[model samples]
Target: MMRSLLDHLLIVPIVLPLVVGGAMLLLGERRTRLKAGINVAATAALLATAVALLRRVNAGGVEVAVYLPANWPPPFGIALAADRLSAAMLVLTSIMALCSLVFAIARWHRAGVHFHPLFQFQLMGLNGAFLTADLFNLFVFFEVLLAASYGLLLHGSGPDRVKAGLHYIVVNLVGSSLFLIGVSMIYGVSGSLNMADVALRIAQMRDGEHLLLQAGAAILGVAFLLKAGAWPLNFWLPPAYAAASPPAAALFSVMTKMGIYVILRLSLLLFGDDAGASAGFGSHWLLLIGLITLSFGALGMLAAQNLPRLVGFSAIVSSGTLLAAAGFRSPAVTAGALFYLVNSTLALGAFYLLLELIERSRSYGADLLALTREAFGLDRLQVDDDDDADTGDAGVAIPAAMAFLGLAFVACALLLTGLPPMSGFVAKFVLLSSVLNPGGLTPDVGSGVPASAWVMTGLVIGSGLTGLIALARMGVRTFWAPSGRAVPRLRVIEVLPITALLALCVALTFQAGPAMRYFEAAAAALHAPHDYIRGVMAARQVGATAGVLP
Candidate 1:
C-alpha cells in the first residue's frame, strides 16, 4: 500500500489545488473565512506532499518516477515525471505558494471576490507546469497559469494595476501566440510532442530535418525569453511586478522562474550534447541575453526608488543569472546554478513579502515627502556608523515592530548583495567556482576556463557590488533617514511568513553541502538524461489492461 501510494504522489500537487479551487467557486464571497481556511489547508497539504516527492526523488534509487494519470503509455498519454529537477521545482513552488497564500490571508485576500479560487488555480498551473512530461500539457499549463495571473494581477483593481495589468496581458497574449506557433512547428518537425520522444527522435533525425527543428526551437525560445523578462522585451516585467499586491508579487518571482525552468528543461533534454547537429543550440543567445539583462537589472535597481520596483529588478537579475549558468552547459556549473536558483527565489519572495510590512511606515505619501526634502537639500545627513544612526541619539527606544522590519530588511540586503554568511554568498561562490573549474574542484592551468566564464565571473561579482550599493543606500534611507516614521502595524501572521521564508534561506547556508550534492546529481542527470527518456518512454499504467510493454 505504501509503495502504491508513493508511486502516485506526482498527481497530488496538481490535483489537490485544482479540486479545492473549483470547490471555492461554489462558495460565495460572504464565506470568506471558509474560503480562506480551505485555500490555506490545501496549500499546506500541497507543500507537504511536494516535500515528500522531493525526498523520494532524492533517494538515488529513483532515477525518474513516472506517473500516468490515464491508462496509457508515454507519447500517447499524459505523463507526470518526478526527477530531482522537477521535484525541487515542485517543492519551491509549493513553498512560495503557501507563504504567499498565508500572507494574503491577513489582508490581500479581501481585495477581490475570486482571489481565493484564482490563487489555488495558479498553484495548480505552476505544479502542473513543473511535472508534465510533454509539450502539449506544458502549453496547457502555461495557459492555465497565465490566465489565472491575468485575474490575480488586477485583483486589487487600482489605477496602477489596471494600467500595468493591461500591458502584462497584451505581452503575454503575444507570447502565447508565439508559443502555439512554436509548438505546431516542433510537432510538425518531430511528429511527437512528448519531450523525451522528441529528443530521442532528434538524436536520430536526418540532416534535412535539423534546420526545421532548430527554427522551431528558436521561436519557442523567444516566447520563453519574453516571459522570463530578458532585455529588450523586459520593460513590462518591473512595472507589472511592482504594481501587483505583495503576495501576488512574491508569487510572480517564481512565475518568472517558470519561464527559465522550461528553457533549462528543453535546452538540456532536447538539445544537450546528445542532439547531433543541434547540440548546444541557442546557448550563445542565452549567455548573451543573460549578461545584457543582468546589467539592465543592476541599472534598474540603481534607479528604482520604490521598494517593489527594486525587488522586481532583482527578480530579473535572478532570471539572468540562471540563464547564463544554463548557457555554460557544464554539469558542475549547472549544479551550482540550481542551488543558487533556489536561494535567490526564496530571498526574492521573502523580500517582496517584507516590502508590504515595511511600507506601512511610509504611509500618506511619506516617501514623496522624503524625496522632496532631499530635492531641497533638507534630507538628514547620511548615517555611516551605528552610533551615528539617523533614527536616534542613544536615548530613543525602537519599537519591536520597527526592529523586526529593520532586521528583515538587513537580511534581504545581505542575501541580495551576496554578502558573507548568507546563502546568497554561498550560492555565488559555488556557482563561480564551478564555472572556473567546469569539470571538477581543481582547475587545469593548460586549459583554463572559457573567456565567457571569466566575463560571467566578473559580472557576478560586479552585480553583487551593484546590489550592495543600491540595497544599502535604500536600506539606510528607509531605516535610518526616515527618523520619525511610524512603527508599522504588523500582525504575527504577516511577520511569521517573512521570518519563515528568511529562515529557510539561513538553513540553506548551513546545509549547503547536501544541497550542492543533490544539485550536482541533478545536473549530471540533465546533461546525460538517458534515465529521463527511459522513464518517460517506458512508463506503464498502474494496474492497466493494455498491450504497452517496456
Candidate 2:
C-alpha cells in the first residue's frame, strides 16, 4: 500500500500544475496576489515532487518507475515514466520555473492578464513533456507548451514583440505540422505510439519498413532540432526570446532544452545499437548542425549591441553546445553534457532576469545623445537594422546598486563563458575531458581519435572564447562606461531568485563529484536502455484501478 502510494507520486509534477492553473484561470486577473500565492504554493510543491522523484530514481539504481494514469497498460494508456534522465530534467525544470515565478512576482507577472494561469499551464506542459513516455503524448505536450509560450511571449505587447511573436508562432506551427506528420508515419509503420514499443518495432522491422522509419525519423528530427535552436532552423529564436518578458525569457531557456531532451530520447531509443540498419542514425547531422549553430551563435553574440539580444544568442550557443556534446554519443561525454545543461540553464535564467533589472539602469536619453552628437558630426553615425540601441551612457554611477550589478554580471559572464571558479567552467572541463579522453586523461595528440572529436574540441573552446569577448564588451558598456543612467532599485523578490540560481550553480560546482557520478550512471542507463525498456514495456496496472478504467 505504501509502495503504491509512493509510486503514484509520479503524477504529482504533471497534475499539480494542471489543477492549480485551471483554478487560477477561474479566479480571473483582478486578484493578482491571490493567484500569485497559489502559483507559489503549487510551484513549490512541484519542486518538492521533482526532488522526491529524483531521489527515488537515484536510490533505485538503474530503475524506471512508470505511472499508468488511466490504469491501463501501455501501448494503450497514458504512461509517464521516471528514470534518472527524466527525473533530472524534472528537477531542473521545476527549479527554473520556481525562480522565474518568484522573479515575475516583482513585476513581470502583471505584464498582461492571465499571467498566473498561463505560467502554471506552461509548467504543466513542460512537466508533461519531460515525463511522458508516449510519442503522441509528447506531441500533445509539445503543443501545450508551445500554445502557452505564444501567450507568454506576447504577454507584454510591443511593436518588436508583436512582430517577433508572429514569426515565433508561424515557425512553431510549421514545426508542429512536421511533428504531427512524423508521428503519423511512425505510428502507421510501427502501430504504437508508446516509445519503447516503437523502438521494439523499429528494431524488428523489415528493410522496407526501415526506409519509412528512417524518413519519419528524419522529419521528426528537424522539428526537434529547430526547437533546440540549431543553425538555419533557429533564426526565429533570438528575436523572439529577446522580445519576451524577463521571467518568460528565463523559462524559455529550459523550453529550448526540451527539444534537445526529446531528440536525445527518441534518437537513442528508436535508433540505438539494437536497431541494426538504423544504428547511429542522424549522429553526424546532429554533430554538424551543432557546430554550425555554435559558430552562428558566437558570431551573433559578437555583433549584438544590447543585453537582451546578446543573451538570446547566448541561448543559441548553449543549445549548440548541448547538441554537439550529445552528438558525440559517448556516455562519458553525455554525463558532461548533462552537467552542462543544468549549470548553463541556471546561468541563462539568471542572466535573463538580470537583463530586466540592468535595463532599468540604462538612460534612454543616452541613445538620443549619441545620435545628436553624430548628427552634429562630433561622433560617427552608424546603426545596424538588427542591432538595438547601445547600453553605453555617461554619468555618475551609484555605489551600492552598481556593486550588485557588477558582481551578478560577472557571475553570469563567468558561467556563460565557461570561465573559472564557477559551474560553467566545471561543465566545460567535464565535456572537453570526456571528448578528448574517453578512456584515460591524456591522449597521444591526434593519434587514434576521430577528426570530429578534434573539431568539437575546437568549437567548444572557440565559442567560449567568443562568448567571453562578447560578454566582456557588453559588461564594460553596461557597467563601466560613463553613465547618465540612474541606479535601479533592487527588489528582494527580483534579487533573491537570481541569487538563488547562481548559488545553485555554486552548489553544483561544490557537489560536482557526486553530480558527475550520478550523471555517469544516467549516461550508462541511457546508452544501454535495457532497464528503461523493461520499465516501460513491463509496466503493470494497479489492482483496484484496472477494472475502473477498462
Best by TM-score: 1
> Candidate 1 regions off by >4 Å?
1-3, 366-394, 544-550
TM-score for predicted model 2 compared with the true structure: 0.92
Tens digits of per-residue lDDT, candidate 1, 1-550, equal 1237777788998889899999999999989899999998999999899889889888778878888887577788888898999989989998998899889888788877699999989998999999999898999999999999999998877677789999999999999988998989999999999999899899888887988999999988999999888988899998898778889988988899999889999999999888999999999999999988888888888898878788888888888888899898899989999999999999999998898677667745643233223323232232245534545545666678889999999899889878889999999999999989987878888896689999899888888888888898888878888654656567898988899999999999999998998998999999898889988887766664433333
lDDT of each: 0.86, 0.85
lDDT of 2 by residue, 1-550 (tens): 1246788889998888889989888896789999999999999999999999999999965378888888777778889998999999999999999999999887667768898888988998999999999999999999989999999998867677789999999999999999999999999888999998888777788998898988998999899898999999999988898888888999999999999999888888888899988889898888888889988999999999888888889989989988988788888888999999999889999998888677666664443223222323232222333233444565433457668888999999999999999999999999989888876467667668888889888888888898899999988888778434556667789899999999999999899999999999888888898788778877777764322211
Error of 1 at 46 (Å): 0.3
TM-score for each model:
0.94, 0.92
Candidate 1 lDDT score at position 204: 85
lDDT measured at residue 232 in model 2 versus the true structure, 0 to 100: 94
- Kindly give the stretch of ten consecutive residues in candidate 2 with the minimal lDDT sum: 368-377
Candidate 1 TM-score, true structure as reference: 0.94
Model 1, position 500: C-alpha lDDT score: 92
